[model samples]
Target: MLFDKIARPAMYRLAYHDPEVVHERTVRLLGRVAPALGPVSRVYRTDDPVTVLGLRFPNRVGLAAGMDKNGLALKAWPALGFGFVEVGTVTRHAQPGNPKPRLFSLPGSDGVINRMGFNNDGAEALARRLAAHGKPGVPLGISIGKSKVTPLDEAVEDYRFSLRALHPYADYFAINVSSPNTPGLRALQDKAALAELLAELGRTSAELGGSTPLLVKVAPDLTEEALAELVEVCLGHGVAGIIATNTTLSREGIAPADAHLAAEIGGLSGRPLAARSLEVVKFVHECTEGKLPIIGVGGILGPDDARRMLDAGASLVQLYTGFALHGPGLVRRVSRGIAGRPC
Candidate 1:
């Protein structure tokens, strides 16, 4: 209530000037104070432990990828009550992503449009930071993507490079091929291409003794047939689970007041994404007959959205835009709500 009433309103005003600036400053501040605040933050932690992909999570709610691309605020997430944190979309090479004005806020629709293009300090840098700071209390999943300069055909090796660099730091890996910002990135989701990529990563996982679980993130925009094929490819390569879905290219639910920003080319997330993401989660769960675990993400904004995803077959749910909009209190509220519910 405090956040929605006060902090959120202040953030909205700041967002009008430059959302990313406010975001960067906030993350840095949290990173600096996380250690001192750790003890107090634990009050929000829920005891509803659940295991997925052979790892135990303190709760079902997690901070999704893209929030901490370089893992700068690793320790802060657990302190803030997140069950897990998926960091990065880091690539083999560090590069400046799409130019400024790349991130936009659509307050009218309670959504965010970003074409960040996987900006990060690269896999090796994140690995070093994790090594220096130590892992957070909760499980940490590293999301790896192809470098923008890397061609589609070489995406296998590009992702392989990041996986190899960060393998020791990640409890699990989220292979990100669904981001709409990178040119030709989503094309890697095609059946044959996805198969080849997963096969190569599968080989690397085997070579590493297969300790870390692998999960593929899919786009909500995929056709039903395409989604089915992607699932088959993931299962074929011994993937541990799937994260459905990533931001959508479609602009179906933008509010009229925010219609002016609708044409911005990027993935749409938050409330606008709830229906499509839930639909994808249900479809994947039903298609796999519940054999495969799922980490549902996209438009989750509160406890109810989290419950719907779990009931739809997601073993866990992640928060991105919601966290940005509602502040840390949302994590506690959602965690407590889920903890109070029957499993």
Candidate 2:
């Protein structure tokens, strides 16, 4: 409540100046201090234990990818009340990503638009950091992506390299092929490409014998036919689960006051994404007859949104733009709500 009423407004004012600056500073500050303040900065902890993808999550709410691209503030997340934290979208090689002003806030619609292009310090860096600091209190899922310089034909080897490097650290792996910012990245989501990629990754996991669950993060922009094909490919390749509905390229619900910002090319997330993301989750859940677990993400802003996602058959829910907007308090609220609800 304090965050929504007081701190959030102050942050909004700062956001008007430079959102990325505030973001980087916050992550860095938290990265440096969170481990030390671990016991003191803690919030609500729910015992609503549920196992998905062969791992137990303390609660349903998790910190989504992109917020901690390089895992800098990893230890801070569980203290802030996230049941789990998915880090990176890290690539094989370090890259600066797109030019500045790549991240934008649409205050009017309570949304964010970003074309960050998977900017990070690379997978080996993250693995080394995790090795030094250790994993957070909760489950840590590592999301891996293709590097910009890597050709489409060699994407398999590219992803394989990162997976091999970070394999020891990740509790689970999220294969990201959804972000619109990366050119030709989404092409990997196609049937043949997806099949080949997952088959090799599946083989890699088998070779490791770790049984680390592999979940694919998909875009909300795919057609029904395309999604069905992707689902089939996942099953064929032995994928453990799916992280349905990454950011959307569609600007359908941007508030008119913020419609001008819609012209900026990137994936749009937050409230506008709630409906479509939920739709995709429900479709996937129904199609799979709830056999495959789904990590619901995209537009969740509060407990109600999280509830709707869970009710729609998502086994878990993740927050990104919503967390950036409402602060960590939102995690407690959502967790409590899910905990108190009848199953």
Full-model lDDT for every candidate: 0.91, 0.90
Candidate 2: Cα lDDT at 334? 87
- How many residue pairs in model 2 have overlapping backbones? 0
Q: Give the TM-score of candidate 2.
A: 0.97
Regions more than 4 Å wrong, model 1: 340-343
lDDT of 1 at 132: 92
Query: lDDT score of model 2?
Result: 0.90
Mind giving the per-residue lDDT tens digits that candidate 1 earns over 59-98? 9899999998988888888988999999989999998899
Q: Write the per-residue lDDT of candidate 2 for residues 189-292, one digit (tens) a residue.
A: 99999999999998888888858999999999999999999998988888889998899999988999898899999999999999999999999998888888
How much lDDT does candidate 1 score? 0.91
Pairs of colliding residues, candidate 2: none
TM-score of decoy 1? 0.98
How far residue 302's Cα lies from its native spot in candidate 2, in Å, is 1.2
- Cα miss at 205, model 2 (Å)? 1.2
